[model samples]
Target: MFCKAFRVKSHTALKSSDRKKLRGDISSTFPSLTTEKLAELMPPKEDLTIAKVFVHKGDAVSIYVHNRNPIIFELARNFYPTVYTLWRHPDLLPVFTTWPPVFERMSGGADLMLPGILMSSFGLPEVQQGTLCAITLVGNRAPVAIGVATMSTKDMLASGMKGKGFNILHTYKDQLWAYGDESCPPNIPPEEIEVAPSANLEEGYLDSESPAYITELENLHLEEVSATVQQESGEIKLSTETFQEEKAEIPYVENCNTSLQETMDDLLHQCFFHALKYKVKKSDLPLLTSAFLRNFLFACCPEGQQVDIKKSSYKKLSKFLQAMQQRNILQVKELSKGVESIVEIQWKHPDVISFVAPETVLPLETCETSDGGRKQPYQPPEILSLYGINAKMLPLFQASGHRKGDLLTANDVRSVIITYVKTNELVHSDNKNFVTVDPVICDCLLNASEKHDLLLLKWDDLVTRCLERMQPSHRVAFPGSSPVVRKGNIEAIDISVAQRGSNKKVTIIKNLELYGLDPVSVGSLLQQRVQASFSCTVLPGTKDRVQVQIQGNQVSQTGKLLLEHFKIPRKYINGLDLAGKAGKKK
Candidate 1:
């Protein structure tokens, strides 16, 4: 169901009470989960977000995201586990195993057909219709898909294991999984992978064209049955260790001399040079080391390939880049204490000059820098602090046809007062700037001193007093959402420098959630930009609001990130002057 992209309706941090309720709900729903296991899934200290989304078919789904991965989602009040959640606890639900090749079809939104299932001698797990279940590959225990049973085990066997088995909702490579870190399924070994029974010779089973395929499957099933029968009769014996080792054999390089580590190092260097030759441009210089690796180097990798630095001899991107620097391929500079950048590149260097550009390069989009191009993240609507019409200002607003509780900007307030004066013909004929103060205006917009003596007021004075008499409020309107009016002033993004321990200084930022900036994402971006260590902590007396703490004084960088990257107005951000003299001001 989640194969296509979905629209996010609302993303908000789940309240503590709601979180507790959800935990209880999940515990009751999945009774096998213990208190400790549930705590691990939904950590108390971590931020849990409940995102309301509309799928392609306009079905509303409430997804609970933890650590950027959607663990659970609710559709029609029915909770379903995500593939991410099933990975850790594979046996949480009744599992059905299928051939590896069937996953490609399932990822494309196809249902799990009985023909595709690898039936074991023990038969399928007994499940009622609409019971949530997990699907795993033939040899791997890690679940790659989740769905509800379309029929019970009795019905499935009664029908000779034909027709649909499970209605696949979310799959490994679907849009739901893309919402996460996009980590591949782990290679978890299955306890007992079985072959399908050959009794039901359904036509077009597994889309097989040749009879040999069906014959081979039946032979495999028979072989297993024969072996089991022989073992029971003491006619043959099998070594458990050898059998497990064969089943768990990971496909590595056939050559014994070459290690996987060496292969990874070669792959990293190949990708690095490929990026330099075909991807990296001169404008991209002064690129952050982290960005260079994540954006440029990784994008240059061939399709279906990945570079794992941990497996390489260099072990780190910095070490790999340092080795490249030694080879005169690029100049790595530590512009800041920990932050490193590729300030210059040797385009004419022997290695770069001799590198051949591939005819077909992966069409991967890299993030645009401020100079290279504009790559903006999803920014929330600009917050506007305005006046809300209260009971005191209701009389004046009513004269202009504005109801109470109507939020108005300064210009809006002035316009309303002017409209009221003109409609009442209270403007002085001699001087248009002066307005005859009516009883309603006198009561709502005037103080005791001004009301007792002054009958006529200047237009500006009338407007100013009208604003002062109104209650303070703010409005926030996210895209595709209605404007929300809240009481009191909006909290500003607060940045301050505090001394940690004796000598260490740290920059602390808070109130980011109010502005739609995720503290975790912001801190990660800041860490990459400044090459500093950072941490996110939930603020006390707040509804799961996070505060970002970074090493050293990062007032300048933090301000720039909010101003440039997030496009937040300076008025909404505090501590600009605290950024020191070198900080950019606008």
Candidate 2:
């Protein structure tokens, strides 16, 4: 029949820390040492010779230690170290249990156990060492097994058993309990062994800090780049033929490695062009088209252009034709009809116009100035282009493109001696009377001239050079010659000074109080004199209103004008006063 037995548990937890206190306690209570002369009388003992090894005959071993000395604190560590080495051997490990009594003294008919007792004898001091150092084996204690290693006691003492990794040894007090003895120390617990985390967890791709390999590699690379030209070589030219051969292998490049940079310029131009279709200033539209096309061609067109016009961009544009017709946005017979009518025949734009022309007769600023002289410091093409004039007329400013000019000046700017004004002018009728228009026309230009007063600075020479020449001939004669505030046909001229040094400017052009004249024409002429400067203000009769052209060359009133016109204000003139008392003589 098999029976379960309890092997010793680990005694590493014994906590030898109380040894000092225990020593103090023992010294205070126990009597001082007295060497028993009897230890000297019993002559030196012979070698330990076991006649019969009675190890665990039933439960425990019986042995005698001759002339054992008293235990003391001075030699405790040296004494304890030898006993601790016993359990290092596998063969001696099983038998070691609790601390064996150093000496069992008979006192008052009771057995007294004296532990950690130092003794003097051949096998005594070395009882925990040598071949006797093996621990007692103790699985089944009925017949305990005695552990042994085939080596001399001295050899065993000199070379202690090698440790079994985390395994622990056992001893009794300061003496290692021999293998044949009954005492055994407890075994250590499993929880005391702890395992660390794996190496992969400590070193991972997404960790806060990168792996060592990359950092070290980058540092090595920078070192190489910085040492491109060493001090040992005094001078070097990268462009030399030999160097060039080496450099060619290095592969010089200009951002060719960048992703999609080559197409960015064209893409940007296309976006701007497509966006321009929604809303843009009338004046700016032509300039926008010019800028877009010029930059676009420079950016997108392959150099050394060989454009076959019919085939160029035809395929890309052609695809949209079918999509347009099938939707029936506009009903059409077929793709051919749509293409022929819309795309091929009438879709003309001057974007493709060339620069060169013959017999176009370009402009020269000095156009036979009576004595034939030239005017230097010519204005740029944009000045002439503002009025929608042809570019060929301006020799100085034109870059062979469309141009516009102020018709008032260019036609009459020449220096000529003419003493008389044209007697029959638009303002001067055949009978020399002021031309009368629907009074509303005068009201409209005065109403529109209100967009002024944002001005912080004033030009001292408010009248233009061209107008100054015409002033002598037309200031007292024509409305255009008078200084006025203007926005196209809308104007405020014939300004009545509010008060002396009033600092007020341009109230109304050709007010009803004055004789007839169109303020729009006057204001336009005045605006021409100042180039294209404008100011912002609101007139007395108008509030948050402006004259915007509704139809071609014609404008409509808005805001307060609409309100005031519909509701005519009743005029009340206080009756003149009559003095009655002073008239008694009458």
**lDDT values for all models:** 0.73, 0.23
Locate the minimum summed-lDDT window of 10 residues in model 2: 1-10
lDDT (10s digit) by residue, model 1, range 417-529: 77788888999999988999889988887778888888899988877777777889998875544778788889899999999898999999998867766665577566655
Instruction: Show where candidate 1 strays beyond 4 Å.
Output: 1-96, 99-117, 120-135, 138-180, 186-197, 201-314, 331-344, 347-377, 382-386, 428-432, 580-586
Error of 1 at 416 (Å): 2.1
In the predicted model 1, the residue pairs found to clash are none
- Scored by lDDT, model 2 comes in at 0.23
* TM-score for each predicted model, relative to the true structure: 0.56, 0.14
Best candidate, TM-score-wise?
1
Off by over 4 Å in 2: 1-219, 224-314, 323-586
Candidate 2: lDDT of 317? Answer: 28
